[model samples]
Target: MIKKLLPFIGEYKLETILAPVMITIEVALELMIPFMMARIVDYGILGDGGMTYTIQMGSLMVLMAIIALIFGALSGRYAAIAGMGFAKNIREGLFKKIQTYSFANVDKFTTASLVTRLTTDVTNTQNSFMMVIRMAVRAPVMLIGATIMAVSINPQLSTVFIFSIPVLGTALYLIGKFAHPRFLDMLEKYDSLNEKVQDFIVNIRVVKAFVREDHEEEKFVDNAKRVKDAQLNAEKLVVLNMPIMQMTIYTSVVAILWFGGNMVIEGTFNIGELSSFIMYIMQVLISLMMLSMVFIMLIISRASFSRIVEGLEEKPVLDDGDADPQLKPENGDIEFKDVSFSYSDDAEHAVLNHVNLSIKSGETVGIIGGTGSSKSTLVQLIPRLYDVQSGEVHVAGRNVTQYKLNTLRDHVAMVLQNNVLFTGTIKENLKWGNEEATDEEVIEAAKAAQAHDFITAFPDGYDTELGQGGVNVSGGQKQRLTIARALLKQPKIVILDDSTSAVDTATDAAIREVFREHLNDVTTLIIAQRITSVSDADKIIVLEDGKINGFDTHDNLLKSNTIYQEIYESQSKGGGINE
Candidate 1:
């Protein structure tokens, strides 16, 4: 995992390298200061050397301290640069990877999980990387340097740290082992918490309409409590670290003071040496404490790193492969040859069966299906949003997989069942269909969609800012706006999946007229629940339980197909048809 992340450290390579080098220099200077203090006490202050020698050593100590401070500050600055830069690159790379994922790939991960990985997980890894380069290097180096000095001064007193070090190390290892999995579990709980919040906020209007505010609040509190419980469980093991460190640190300190004091009185140890020995013991033990903190951070960061890498390493389910790069979609003619698909590979049955159908360019066909009849799934294959399991889906005289994904999708425009508009001006949102569209072109497309008059009635007209998801617009208006946007693409194939469900029959009829007038040459597929919506199509396909129960015009279907006859009769009672 570390090796994979190393490449993204790219431009920050110098900062990453310099951080540890500067930290090492700072540690060296720090170690020298203690030794210099020993000299000032033993020879300059207590023994024959006196004031002149003391002043010289003191001046040198101050210089080393200043250098150490400068090095410490530089290491911190470089560590921040490297850590933040690495995170920025990872975020960009992760988003790009997500953009490449097919719909099936997106189904494997939730929105909340991805958001958590991009934000909180990345932050955790960044902080860990910074500490790893700075304190991580300094801790071990200081421990080793302090141990060497202490042992040389007097091995007997130093043995106290030797005994204490292993015990603290063992405790820290156990804490990390017990806490690592819990931390991973905690992160999962955080994902759930975020999901609950997102779900509630996105559906806030629905909640209010249903008077379910109390219910939503309870749901949010339950998710938040789950997160708190998971976090507390992980921290239970981590909290042991502090108590163990305190006991070991104080025990080692008392042992050194006792042993060094007796040795000094016994004439084997000098006062300066004893003082330096105590300082070295403090350094060694404090370094161990810092190391334990790093250990805990590593445990959390390891979990976050694994989650991030999971996203980055995922292979896109659909790849254009080594197909002829020059191959391009030429027209909107579509064919499904014995095609079958299931969202999951292990599903007991396919959402689409061995269906064979062909539509010539410029033909407008209507598809009607009962619930769970895979109406959306059937058309999704045209643009290769999902690959067929057993057979082929061809567009423009070539298998969709042979063309570049962007090239195939560019020529096939879909207005999905759920009409979505972004948070932008109406013109900006429409520009998504064709970035180069002019104001006149935009007006024309909206006029074709029967959306221009109402749009002009708005105070800002084309410049009206839409709330997120176009919440500011009526449902019928939002649908018409989406239709206008899709029309602006001027694609050879247009798929409207229940795209007129919200519009009144009059507006629906007018929009169909516009389709006949302006988009007559483009191959169009309409999926609708109402029989009247498809009554006038060139052909109508009736699907039942993933199979084509009937394929004919409305009048022929009502005469021959039982399923179509039932649907037509039901909608007829509701006065759905005009003629």
Candidate 2:
């Protein structure tokens, strides 16, 4: 697991190496302080060597302390650099990988789960990396070095460790063993909590409209309580680690004082040497406590790292990397050959079934279907948003899979059913379709989308800033702006998937007129529920039960296609899309 994370360390390799080296130096110098104190007490103050020797040893100890402090500070700085740098790299890597994922890939993980992995999971893993580089080096070095020095001073006194060490070790092993799974459970609860919060925020207006604040609050309380319970279950075991280590430490100290007191009475163990031995024993116990802390943190971070690794290592379900980069769509013509698609692999569960359709360049085609008839699903295949489970989608003259994704998608622009806008100025949002679009081109597309008149009414005009998802705009205005943005692409193929539904019929007619007159070389596909929206199209397609029931001119469809006649009559009785 640790090996998988190492690559993200990348340019931080220098800091990673330096942090441990600094910790080693700091530990070595700290160990010498007790030895120096012993010399000052035993030889300078008590032995024939007098005040002058004591002063010399004390000065040397102060100098070593200063050096150790410097090294310790340096180690902390390096660890911070390495840990933070590692986290930044992983975040960028995860986002980059996600961008390559097809719609099917994104469907595998929810938006909330991905956000938690990027934020909470990455933070936990970074802290573990810092602890390992700093405390991980300090604890074991302190333990081994203190043990060796204590043995040299009095080997018989060191025998106290033979009893105490095993007891502390056994307690820690049990704590870690039980605590790991609980931490995993706690992390799962965090994902759920984040999902709940995210869903509420995205739909806050809906909640208020329905007057369901109290119900939503009660659900939040339940989720928070689950998180608290899971945390306490794991933390209860981890808390045992400290009390057991403290008990072992205090027991060893009392036993040492009793045995060393007798040796002092017999004048065998020097008083100064006994003091230093006790100090070394304290260091050993404290180091053991630190080591235990490092292990506990690792247990917590292990779950977080696994989630991050799972996201990082997920293979995007779509790949066009090996396709010909130079292959370009020559015309707007599109063809579907016996295509079948399912969100799942089960062919019987398909949303689009055995579909065959061919659209000529510059033709305006309307697709009408009842709900769940797969009108949107059919158009999505042209740009390869999701691959067909069987058969092929052809653009221009070649199968879509033969062209690089960027090349294929660049020439096919879609204004999706859900219009999304980022936080930016009007100009900035429009430029998403064509980053290099000039001011003249921007105005022309807006005019063609019937957005220029309303946009100019604002004081800021093209420079007006939009809120997230363009909350400031009316539904009809948002739809027009998205249409303008898509038009800026100057794509060979344009798809409006119920995109203009919010616009008034008059404006909808004007936008269609613009497409008919101006986009003479571009193939246009309009998916609409209103029969009037597609009534004047060069051709109309009627879909039913995931298959093409009829594909012909609108006049012929009204006479022959029963599905089309039924939809037309139902909407006619309802007075059309205005409802």
Number of the top lDDT candidate = 2
Task: Write candidate 1's Cα lDDT for 1-579 as tens digits.
Answer: 877877889899999999999999999999988888999999999888899999999999999999999999999999999999999989988899999999988878788988999999999989999999998999999999999998888887778879987798799889888888999999999999888988888889999999999998998899989999999999999989989999999998898888888989999999998988889889998999999999989887888999999999999999987667777777889998998888889556788888889899998899998999999999999988999998999898888888889888888999999999999999999989999999999999999999999999999999999999998999999999999999999999999999999999889989988898888899999999988788889899889887788888878988999999888888778787667
lDDT of every predicted structure (CA atoms): 0.91, 0.92
What stretches of model 1 exceed 4 Å from their correct place? none
Tens digits of per-residue lDDT for model 2, 1-579: 789889999999999999999999999999998998988899999997799999998999999999999999999999999999999998989889888878887788877778988999999999999999999999999999999999999999899975888898888788878888998899889888999999898889899999999999999999999999999999999998888888888899999999999999999999899999999999999999899899889988888888888988898887887899888999998999999999898998999899999999999999999999999999999998999999999999799999899888999999999999889999999999999999999999999999999999999999999998898999899999999999999999999999889998999999999999999899999999888888889899898889999999978998999988888888888888442
What's the CA RMSD for each of the models? 1.6, 1.7
What would you estimate as the lDDT of candidate 2? 0.92
TM per prediction: 0.96, 0.97
Worst 10 residues of 1 by lDDT: 321-330
